[model samples]
Target chain A: MQLFFQHLINALQWGSFYALIALGYSMVYGILMLFNFAHGDIFMVGAYIGFGVATALAALAALSALALPNWVILVLTILIAMYLTSFVGMLVERIGYRPLREAPRASAAITGLMIGIILETGNLAILGAQRIRFPSLIKTQVYDIGGVVVTNKKIMIVVVSLVLMLALNEFIKRTRWGMAMRAMAFDYVVIPLMGVPLNTIASLTFALGSALAAAAGILFAVAYPVLDPYIGITYGWKAFVAAILGGRGSVKGACLAGFLLGFIEIFVGAYLSSSLRDLIAYSIILLILVFRPHGFFGEPHSAKLRL
Target chain B: MRKGLLLVVAILVVGLALSPCAWAKSKTIKVGINAPITGDIPKVGEGSKYAAEMWLEDIKAAGGLQVGGEKYMVEIIVEDNESKPESAAKAATKLITEDEVLAIVGPQASSQAIPAGEMANNYGTPMISPWSTNPDTTKDRPFVFRGCFLDPFQGPVVANFIKDEFGFKKAAVLYDIASDYPKGLAEVFKEAWENINGPGSVVAFESFTTKDADFSSQLTNIISSGAQFLFTPQYYNEVALIVQQAQELGFKGPIVGSDSWGSAETVKLCGEACYGLFFSTHYAAAGATGATKEFIERYEKKYGYTPDDVGALTWDALRLVQKAIEDTGKLTGNLKNDRVAVKDALAKIKEFDGITGKMTFTPEGDPIKCAVVVRISEKGEFEFYKSACP
Candidate 1:
């Protein structure tokens, strides 16, 4: 029972991570009809941004020779990092992906590879190769529930993910621009007919998705306080798989698929050899994609402006 | 005024061109140190550069690598590998083909040194790896060598350390299967451990990608396996998260690791819960021998930080190459022949006092160095425990 509970909590934390990033992927794919390969790199940017800000704050605190309040520094770092990295996301779209939006799919993929390399290269130049230690945002106080010492941050992660997701759903359903976005995704030719500016919608869409990625990045660093440039590549790929599995255009399906992926990965690694974890996870994605040409949540022939 | 500016530019350009000679005339012989100054393993790679730079300065102060009847000055050339395998290959190529260096040291991790090894082998340039411990790195490469012990030696040492320190009868192992160093070390430790503790001592031997973030499932299974010891011969980030999550899962047993655990950042990321964990490494700051003490004093005076295993191995590697160069007694002519001579001289090295210990290479061209044990403190520092090597 104890082992079962621990594994379940483990699944929940991992699932929360999937869900957080999957929302951005699904939303961006829904709006842009573009496979945003740079999304993961943007997430990495978010983590680094958070690390830089936090390190600075920590340094200042150290210089003062007095312990600063942990919560204040933590919240400030996450928010500042999210804002800065969101701008980076905005810049990525403008510099990397936007110019290639009208180009060939292969061109965009190549651009994505370049962006990934650039972000990683920039990290190499800036942070040096070693993983920088991040200060924990949440206290590591585990609350015992059914013999599982559930970490406070994990609970925060699940709660925060739900809150952000609900908020996103509300924004999409309640706002006028959300309706315009939905219409645009259905057909951009009719978008100008509906008096919706495509460029404005596109930027807004990237901004929203990037903001969410920033949040996930900060949360991820909280649970695992080691920041590196390449860390986001794996998560980005996994979350992308999750988005596609749930149906790339469908937010609800994305969340469901992400949770499903998390469950499968955790259970397999726990029950089977952890060495084979990646192989199993990727194989599952392949199987699903092979059968379901349209992702579990995404529609077939989903087309939108890529960049 | 235009002619005056042009003439001024000409004189300045000529002066700048001849300045290398001017600098060289100051009695400094350039000791080219090429490593991943930027990119994924920069901590380890930069440590290599730092150690080399510090050692070169000391050697220059103490009459640099004394070649046959002459004392040459030392200058360090640091390069960036950017963490890509091809980039590492390029760096080695540039350092050898273009730079025509006397000796080269680094491109730190095993994933990197493989390409660097071949590059050095082709050019007959003697290159030393500070911490790239995969035995295959130096397996067939005559000119490539290392100063620290390889993963095979480290594996048994860590296994024994855990078995004795934690009184662990059984252990669970997890590492990247793709990495030669991690897999080789895990295999050796598994055999040595099972031999002593009997069969079925390994409860859950799992594998994962080095790039993975969620290792909870593996840690949970290890905890459930009733294993007293946990071994993760993985990279620092994954190991930190594994340690953090392992403690969170309520398994407070001693976790053992390889030399990759030498970084202070790894321990800080793992936090307070990972205290008391032991790892096998090359150098511990405590119990310094006279030579090591001098090296430490010189390094601290130069770089302003205490030397870790990476730093120590780098110092030794550079010194080994310099020793080989001195034995060759040739400065410029027939450079290829000089390179081969250096390679031969490097192999002839036996029981030289290194920063870690007396280091020598086997016939396979792999360095034989003593492995030391260090335990993590509650304050997140590595405390020297004991040494374990033949």
Candidate 2:
């Protein structure tokens, strides 16, 4: 029972991060009937930005010889990171997504791939192909949630993710632009017809989603604390899988899928042999795709990638 | 007049460029270095090339390489493999068949080195891998020999350190399964650790991908599992991230790793977060004795940065190969005899005081080098601790 509870804790903690990432993926997919192949990279960008800003601030403090307090430095660095990452996300949408909006689906998908490569290669060139560790907002501490061990980091991850998610949910549901976004999701032709301001909405969606990813990236650093150029690629792909598994276009589904995916992974790794864990988890995902092709919670896709 | 001058200058530049390979007589024996010039692991490839270049310069300046009855200059032909396995194999094929190299020096990563090893083995050409620590790269391959210890040896080096030095009862393990390196290291570490401390002491064993952005989940469970120490055998990139996350998850206990942590990138990436983390590596620049000072000085003069363990190993590999060629005095002869002579010479060699340590190869083709334990200082630099080969 203790082992089971421990595994459950493991699942919940991991699931939160996965859900946060998947939320970014699902939101982008929802707003633009396009899969931002680079969303995962956007997450990476956020984390690297966090790492860079923190390091630079730390260096500056060293130069002045002030030796700033850890928390003040950390918070200032994270805010800078969030702003920079959101800007990058907006830029990606502008340069990468804008040109191909009206082009052939193949071209748009190719452009998305190119964008993915561009983000990775750009990161490689700028960051020099090394992983940079991001400083946590605070030091880690452990606590118990119902006799199951939970760290302060995990609690922060869970709380922050929930807050951002709720905020995003509120923004979409309560706002006028949010209604238009839903209308656009229903039909793009009706967007301009309804004077919904399509471009602004798209940009806002990218910004919001990007910022969310940035926050998630920060929390992830706080939770895990390493930033690599290619990290986004793996997490992005997994988050995409989560998004699809939970019905890619649905915000709730994406979040649910993320948590579920995390739970499955941790539980399997805990129960089954670690070696078999990856193969089994991925195999189960494949089986789900085989059986329901539309994912467990994913809606009947108008257009989606199964490959 | 302008056109004629331009043509003449172009011709002169071309001639100058071609002089190295074109003006070379058949008397010079060429060694090929296939390097990972691009990609995430470029530093490893770059280090190998830089070290090889330095060694080449030292050997050439010393009046080339001595062949039988005459001295022949050692010519090194470097090809960029771009860090791809296929590219490495292609480079090997091109170097052997087209460039007609007497022997090859590199193809760094084990995944790349294996196929390159196969290419050399097929042609019976000697190839010295500088830092490909995966055991399979040399196992059963007649021509493939390494200048570094295999992952199995290196991994257990740290695992035993964790068990014996720290006296840890249990360890939480995390390793990237995608790499033959980390995969192999993680396995060997488990075997060695459990052998010493018994099984079930490892409470949490988790695997991650090379591209995993978040390892906190794994670390969380590890933190809760009551494991006394953390064991990770990961590349510099992953190690940086792992250490940061590990530290964030409140893991202050000694974290032990393999030689894969022998990178400045690990320090740069982890920064102050990596303080006190320990790893077993081939070389650390403390208490320099024997060839260590000489290597560090020469390398610093050339590269302007401190040489890491991999760099030291590659330099040693180059020197060892050159020594074999010079001793045999048959390196400049027909490719067959030179190859045979170098291979035979490498096998018969007993001892060399290398920067890493006193080294010799076992008949089974593993480097008999000491693996040293190094601790990451508070300022994020590696300080040497101790070494054990016994």
Candidate 3:
């Protein structure tokens, strides 16, 4: 039972990273019918940017003897990284997707893939081949809660992720921009007819999703300080799967599915053989998808009424 | 037509004039350097290249290799394997056939070296793997050789270290199942550990694929098994993540590993979590002496960091090949026969004192050398702990 509780905490922290990134995938797919494949690489870029910001702050503090707390430096890093990465996400949408909006859907998908490659190779070119280590912002303090040790970093990851998710939820529920986004998701044809600038909403959706991914990237670096150019490739794909499993356009569904993924992987690795972790975890997900083809919260679709 | 005929005649004269001069002044010997210069572990490849370049400069300054009373200028042709097995084979083929190299060095990882070693054997060119310790790398291939000790020898060293030093009876293993080198080392350690501590001592044996980012699940099971020690035979990247996650899960037991864990990146990623962890390696950065110490200082001066085991072994490999070439006594100017001579000379190298230590090759082409045990200090540095000799 104690071992079970320990694993549960690990699962929650792992899920937070997936859940945050999956929200980006779910939101972009909800607004635009296209899956933002470059979102994962965007997460990687955000993490690298976070690394840069954190290093600069640390250096500045040393040179000037800035007595600011480590937590303050960490908050600053996350905010600056998210702000800068939002522009990167917006730029990717404008240069890569906007040019091919009127073209075939497959062209846009291919552009997403191309953009992902460019980001990965571009990071490699700029950073050179060495792996960069993220500076530890918070000293690790292990707290034993009834034999279930929880690190300060783990608690911070989960709490910050939930706070961000709730903030996004409140923003989408009450704001005019949120209303415009919901209307656009319902029907792109009627959104522009209602005098809502479709292009602005599209860029806004990408910006919001990219910002969430940046936050996830920063949190992930906190837990695992090693940063590499290719770190985003597999993680991006897995989180994309979480987004799909959560159902299209459902924020709650994405969060649930992300945690579900963490549970499945953690439980499988614990109870069963670690060698079969991926094989079994993915098999269960496949079974779930077979029963619910459209996903946990996705609505059943029929062929649209043709002209 | 007259101008064209004059141009052709001039080209022929120029080529003819340069050919004999090039041959008489100094014939050049090409050595191919195959390494993973652009992949996940580019640092390992970069280290090999730097060490080889240093060796090349030293040889060139001494006025080249003297073979049968003739001097031949040494030239190195390096190709990036891209950390792929097929790419390594292709690179080796290009080196042997196109570049016409007399010998080859590197392709550090076993996965890359094994395939390229076969190609080198087929071409009859002597190829020395700087860090590949898999027994199969040189099992039946006469032309294939390595600078590091094999897993069979090093595995026992680690097991004995745990049994004698720590006196631990319970051991758990978490290895990369997808990797041949790590898997093989893990199996070897399991056998040796069982032999020392008795059977059924390995409580939990778990595995993960290569490039796996998480290891909490594996740790949960290992921690539950009440393992006193953990043996993970994996690269620095995976080991760093494993140690970090293991610490997070509150598993406080000592972690023991193979030589692959001895890297500069290990401490950087694992941080304070890596302190007190131990591993067996080819050489120790701390308390190094003689040629090894000098090489480390020179490498640190040139590369801005201390050389790891990979760099040290690569340096030794180039010197080993040079000694063999000098031992051959003659080149005969024939590629095929000259390659055979080089291989024969390498086979005759019984005992040689390298920077890594005194290396003696067994008949199977694996080097028998002293393996050092190192510990990660609280300052996140690889400190020399002890040495195990065979």
TM-score of each: 0.88, 0.84, 0.93
lDDT of 1 by residue, B1-390 (tens): 999999999999998788664334334444556676655556666677778767766786887667777777676778778756788889888877766676678877887788888888888888887778888788888888887787777877877777776677878987877766678788888888887789888887877766677778877777778888788887666778888877777776777888888875566567776687778888887667788888878777877766778888887788777778887775554557767788888888876877688866688877676888888877677888988876
Q: Tell me how far candidate 1 lies from the true structure as C-alpha RMSD in angstroms.
A: 5.2
Off by more than 4 A, model 1: A1-5, A52-84, A94-116, A301-307, B1-34, B62-65, B70-75, B83-86, B330-332, B366-369
Q: Candidate 2's error at B302, in angstroms?
A: 4.8
Q: Of the candidates numbered 1 and 2, which has the greater TM-score value?
A: 1
| lDDT (CA) per prediction | 0.77, 0.76, 0.87
TM-score of chain A of each: 0.90, 0.89, 0.97
CA displacement after TM-score superposition, residue B261 of candidate 1 (Å)? 1.4
Candidate 3 all-Cα RMSD: 4.4
Give fnat for candidates 1, 2 and onward, in order.
0.83, 0.33, 0.72
Model 2 residue A143 lDDT score: 65
Give the candidate number with the greatest lDDT: 3
The DockQ scores of all candidates, in the order shown, are 0.55, 0.26, 0.60
The runs of at least 3 residues in candidate 3 whose Cα sits more than 4 Å from the true structure, single-residue gaps closed, are A302-307, B1-26
What value does the TM-score of chain B take for model 3? Answer: 0.92
Worst 10-residue lDDT window for candidate 1 chain B reads B21-30
